[model samples]
Target chain A: MRALFLSLAATTILAGIAQAEPAIMPLDRATILAGSPFDFKIELDQVHAAADVAVTVNGQPYASVFGKPAEFVAEEKGKDGKVLGSALIARGLSIAKPGDYTVAVTAGTETKSVTWTVYGTPAVPTAKNVIFLLGDGLSVAHRTAARIMSKGMHDGKADGRLAMDDLDHMAFIGTSSTHSIATDSANTMSAYMTGHKSRVNALGVYADRTPSSLDDPKVETIAEALRRTTKKSVGIVSTAEIEDATPAAVVSHTRKRADKAEIVGMIYDVKPEVVLGGGSAYFLKSGIPGSKRKDDKDYISLFRDAGYTVATTATELKAADGSNSGKILGLFHTGNMDTKLDRSFLKTGTVDKFPDQPGLVDMTQTALDQLSKNPDGFFLMVEGASIDKMSHPMDWDRAVIETIEFDQAVGVAKDFARTHPDTLIVVAGDHTHGVSLIGTIDDDKPGTEMRDKVGVYDDAGYPNYTDADHDGYPDKIDVSRRLAIFSSNFPDYYETFRPKMDGPFEPAVKTETGDYVANEAYKDVPGAVLRVGNLPKSADTAVHAVDDVVLQATGPGSDEFKGYMEQSDVYRVLADAFALGAAQK
Target chain B: MPFALRRRQFLAALPALASLPRMARAEAPELTFDQLYGGYSALGLTFSDKVKLLDGQSVRIRGFMAPPLKAEAQFFVLTRVPMALCPFCSTDADWPDNIVVVYLEHRQTFVQPNRTIEVTGRLEHGSWVDPDTGFVSQLRLRDASFGLV
Candidate 1:
């Protein structure tokens, strides 16, 4: 019996040893853009002397192929003060040629190999400017609902079209991260901004197994690439904080997106010509009342000293537009700006405090106006961020209204594209949500319970949302007959089956024991029922779906965005559009 | 002679007892969350005149308590609304702009987040960093005590 136990333990130990192979960055099947710089790294399972480690590219010594020797670390320590492994890191490595290159590593008893495809673009540029508009967590259901609510559907399909509906070129983008099928805004946008697929919550860098959030394998962001190769202007506009994940992906390099204070420094490092959004909190000194920074750095004064025209309100933004400085930094709120529903109609949120926050359209138009002054052209990215922010809380009314506002920004881009035919317009979502527009909820046909009022199949008749002013948005969200939008997953919460009129919905709240329980504030609402959660208690609200995001584009070089492609592949198209490989400088 | 002496001692204690009611009537000045700030802008927020006047004085404010950083903590954040997201649990979540950090005089048991509480402490304004936790707060209540309202 003792011998049998000994053999069992031996089997387990052998399995552990077999699994401890060396890990490689720029993981297998990675696509690299020629001349774009990236950090190369290798993490070995065990410590080894410098002479014991062997690395080669395409059967040649790695140092000869990369044109430099990598820094060797004897041991890498983890957060718990344990020695993880030995590592080799080569920073700012680039391959100027385009071909299939295989990297093989061997140390002691472990061996690992990865192949990368390096591709190059044509010598001449296809587009002089690129306008990338992203709607966070945009899905087919959002587009359908936005069209139905804003354009008015009849009999089946008798409505106007969204600005995105007219884009001639289209693609289905797979948004999975390198580490998991699920994704977040940071890595997904980073995949578009940098031609590399990184782990979730990471931006412009691969998520290396390290304790430090900043010491990951860095990839060159699009902003840095433009700075490296061209004299074009760059602009980033969003409804979220300027340091939020989506906009921060434009120039940031970190393994964690929550490093807002550090991300502000990165934004300062890149210094995109036009940056308009919220999140002035990080830019302020720690002594300020609304500041979120933990240090004494005041970025507002720094930007002003750098010749930027700082604007804090819409009136100031308008006045700054008339300035000849050609550099504008507009901060509309301390945190994320108020959604359109609150800012324009409801006036329920923090809008009472931040009354003059600019909308997405206003920021996009201002960005274009400023960026166009550069005769060399520009690259502008506009994001409608609240679509995902409100969707997580299951606030369907605010999410759809944000979509309409996003579409108006798309219209602004399309108008710019009409005159500047050399501009390429790409509209996409970083990821998707499981929410869908099933049918309608009719108060007139309602019974006692709210679920009984739900109309599905043929019983789902048209809603009675009216746009009296001919504006895109419906006049009232609390109509008797309204659209029924529901998420596929949620935490334990009360389903009211009505538009949240007071403010954004708070589905669940954390208890003292760290479990999420249904908020009792909505329990007294008539016909509200407690629905058991399908998601884990750890989830506060709905989560991002793993489904593919639909991408639409038009203008020159947009034809390259057809068919199904990986999220990282989208950057290659952008790179190809600008001829970044040819080095215009 | 003993009864006469006891009567005189009781008369002396009556003056000390009479000031108790007057002390109770002079409660700390009540401050609301809405009155904490004078103006809000992207640049920063300005302290209201009332806040400036009440600085370094005992004041009471009613607000919801955010979940503490730990089970037993020396301090907790007081927010105008019950926080839906746990900034400690999720890296992406952030605290609201109107939060006030409360440093307790003694460790007290936390209550439900949805329950409102009135905290009485010396209202202090200006940025101060906690030595132990390194938490930076623009406004704080020092040596505070709270009870559910």
Candidate 2:
């Protein structure tokens, strides 16, 4: 019997050798919400007439199962105007049943098949609201450093705990992209928001072969799912541009996260109750002095006309909190907001230019205050963006401070959860940096070189960071002995074993040959040393790590997140908590 | 004899006196990155009085030359500090607000980003888009010539 079956499979393979298998969107083994809408697409290796192409779902006609016919293109053109292949596309397709579906396509001698699991939530919701707090590039090192810096360590024990440290349930999340082991903020956050894994730099969609960023195969974002099945308000808050990857993943569906200008339009389309962060340049008209848009669209006025209270400063943000409109759009900087170290302490970086920019805590609180007004509950995402931004430059001091700020924001969410016990709060990182907090750097160590001052094991003493004012941040970062952190990978750079007092670190600069070289600015420092890069010369800074991110949650349905899970699986817990599959409205 | 000698001296001095105005014209006023903007806000940026006064006039500024779009391109961006991230190389990076597009008088070899350069050119301000690369700039220097400072 086994020999006969092998022979049958060999005959089937031999009969279809004329062409390669076609490509299918949502790939294989995708888990989708039962009622969530998504795009269905297939790309054939060879062009086939509509008559020759056949599609079926569970051995039935595709149109009958899908309740609609897919549009067929005889020839799909590539970027260079060359005919690549034939294609079939169906937008906004959804399944209402909970089961396994096998979709098969056959065109001439080429065949491809994919299976998807359609899942459904309980008829009743488990959580009234959800607060997702994401610290971009938040790794174990950042958490350890923030704890040691904010709360002093004594006898090898933490004197205090971070707000995220008290979460009831936790999971180790795999953050790899669909195409590679390494990932970026866009792909990881998109996976959590859309329940679908995508390529790097992609959000709410599968990266297709097409050159157009907007035409990718779409997946429904959490914001859209709420808009479809419930009357819940959605809020997005971040220190980076609101149109940035993590926030944009909440409502955008672009193949490229760098499509910021287009992302603004997408955010406007969803019209979240509260949108706060930087990147106002993309919202302004091209005629505006600081505008980055190439088109004439003015999203600031568009959002204002949509009944949003626009605030440009922290003072205005506070005043706008009392706005009867219920919608707030706070844009404090023309670009990314300054780091917490620059905003509240050092007064470096762009702090002089955008001095009144609010921190992540303020934005998160404002979003909560406004969003909680909804009777149907709400979904608010607060991001500590500069944690990742500073991590990229290998500026450990600033990144740790940013993590502290993110933890404070988590505290605010915990405070909200106290009054609204039905609210579920999730604290996670989209991805991680290749950073580690090894030991301490003692200025008093007897050494001619900075590397000699590094302490490890027994010699690694505690950092002298103090929270004199008890604000959960060290009063001074440039202590005599400080936490010694390092990245596993970096470009050629001068390693200055001290805090960057002047501003954020700019370790490397590009040369004429498109290679990165150590910046000579730090060469004059007392004990600076040039460290040859472990990465390629093309890398300007340290890259993201492929390590799994830690996700913690509290409140109803939090038990779903335990042990090990995929980043995309986190969305399932969120959906089940909200009963997104069952229409609540 | 003394009168003839004095007249010869005056004749020689006439050439030097005639060149004084030309020398004054060649001495362009200098500008700094801090002086380019008077006010900055989320709404927009305002050109400083000095920047407004130097418009259409020859000016000199000191800044780091960013990598050009192309190896032999005629223009490049001038930044107040050496750019740690290449916006041209990575789509996620963006140019700072204080960048000035420099259109060189003649294409010159790009310099290392860490080295500051003194550029002399006619100052221009207002929103203008480069037709070749579609790069939009609010401030620019035309016919620029630069040398390491």
Candidate 3:
């Protein structure tokens, strides 16, 4: 027995030795924009003396290639004085050459190697302006539903096509993050804003084993790169909070997307010329009634002091548009703005509180008008964020209506692109949802139960929705016959076939046992049925699906966005389009 | 004293206080969710005159209890509607603008989140950060007791 115990101890020691290899940042096969700045870090498995550690780039000393020496820490400490390991940090390092560069790190007996491609673009730019439109959690069903609901459908064909449908180029974008097969808005949009695929919840940085969300190895965002290389302006517009993941990815560099207050400071650091969205709560001091911050810093007054005209309503946004200040900060709601279905016709949700909030179309047009004042160029990111927000709750009508609103916003961009031929418009989604439009639900069917009214295959006739106002949205979405959309995954929910006219759907509620149960509030709906959840009991709502997002682009640089490509590769095409490698100014 | 011990001592005296309250008590005014907000804007929300008049007075309100912050926590958030997400458990979750914090008079097991409960307590207003939890609440109910309607 003593001999067996000694052998077991020896086996454990050997396993530990086999796993002790150094970790290098700018992970293997990383694609970096040439001349763009990034941080290089090496975390050794064990504490090592400064003299014993060596790092080399392409067979040359690290300082010779990066033009600066790294700061070495003999032992990194944790909260309880726990020795984590030895680490080396090099900030703001760049490579001007366009080729694969291998980095090798050696710390005593431990060694690790990683290869990165430093890519450069042509000297001349192909596009003067770029408009990137992301419909958050957009899936094929949303486009199909939006087209059917907004444009209407005849016997077999759509009455008209969406503005996004007419784009010149298309690609299937793989949106998996570095750490998981599934992706979130932060990592997916961060990949577009920075030429790196990070783990979930991370933006413009690689997820490290640090406890602090802000101490991760950093990557330069597109907004930062544009500022570094050009004299153009930047504009961010979204229906969700301005500091939400999709918009925040353009300027933030944190390991957690929930660092919204810090993200506000990051946005201030970049200072996008025109910023419009619904995160006013974070900008207020903590003592204020509607404030969501934990600090006393008031960002609204700060932005005003910096010459940004603050607008809180649609009328105020239009009024600001007339001014020559050339900068606008619009916070229409304290949180995410009400969806179009609520803001336009229903007058529900938080619309009664924020009565005059601008829709995505109005915000996009205002951003374009203000951004065009710059003769050099501008990069504007317009996000239809509520498509995901409503989807999580299984609110199909609201999500489809938001998609219609998003398409109308696309029409506004396309109209601008028509006149300004040099503008490049790229429309895509950060990720997809587990939603699909199978057929139609007709109230005319002979049945007391709503599920019996669902018509599939040939019985699934086109919906009857009228758009007499010509506002590009259905006059009313709660028509007798409507599109049937369902999520593939959901918690215990009441599947009411009819549209939720009273307000947005709340399909599930948490129980005392910390498990989600079907919300009994909707139990009395005409034909509501309790559908047992397929997801884990811990899930409160439907989750995002791991699917390829469809991307479409138009104008000069659009040809590069073809074939199946990783989400990070799309950023390379954007960099090449504006020739961001070499300074344009 | 330890919080658990202090709480037990408070609970021990609750029955005597309740017997005295039955002798001379006026019916508490009931407040609604809509009555809490006088005006709303992107800048801030104003408390209604009704809410101001009833400050520190016994009031009854009906709302759904959100999932408790912890099994042993002494407070829970009261929301106008059933909360689908627990803000404390989910990293990305955030509370709606008009949640009311309820500090219980005594420790009690959490009730079903979907059921509406009527809570009676002294209405407290203004920004107050909890000393133990550091939670910021604009409106609160002190010494609250709740029962399902």
List-wise, what DockQ does each model earn?
Answer: 0.58, 0.58, 0.63
In order of appearance, the predictions have TM-scores of: 0.95, 0.94, 0.94
C-alpha lDDT of residue A269 in model 1: 93
What is every candidate's alpha-carbon RMSD to the true fold?
6.6, 7.6, 4.8
Model 3 DockQ (Cα-based): 0.63
Per residue, candidate 1 scores C-alpha lDDT tens digits across A1-585 of: 999999999999999877687889988999998998999999998888988999999999999999999999989999997988899999999999999999999999879999999999988999999999999999999999999999999979858999999999999999999989999999999999998999999999988888999999998999999999999999999999999999999999999999999999999999999999999999998999999899999999999999999999999999999999999999999999999999999998899899999899999999999999999889999999999999999999999999999999999999998999999999999999999999999988848888989999999899999999998999999998899999999998899999888888989987777878787778888889999899998888899999999999999899998889999999999999999998887
Give the winner by TM-score: 1
Better of 2 and 3 by lDDT: 2
lDDT of 1 by residue, B35-147 (tens): 99999999999999999999999888999888888876689999888888998889889998888899887666676877787777889998888887888887899887776
Error of 3 at A204 (Å): 0.9
TM-score of chain A of 3: 0.96
- In model 3, the clashing pairs are none
Model 2 agreement with the true structure over A1-585: per-residue lDDT tens digits: 999999999999888774567999888989999989999999988889999999999999999999999999889989998887999999999999999999999999889999999999999999999999999999999999999999889899999999999999999999999899999999999999999999999999998887899999999999999999999999999999889999999999999889999999999999999999999999999978899999999999999999999999999999999887899999999999999999889999989888899999999999999999999999999999999999999999999999999999999999999999999999999999999999999999998888889999989979888787899999899998999999999999999998998999999999878899999999998899999999999999999999999999999999999999999999999999999999988
Docking class of 2: medium
Predicted candidate 3 versus true structure: per-residue lDDT over A494-561, tens digit per residue: 89898899889988889878899999999998898999999999999999899999999999899999
Candidate 1 Cα errors over 4 Å, as ranges = A1-14, B1-26
**Model 2: residues with Cα > 4 Å off, grouped in runs:** A1-19, B1-26
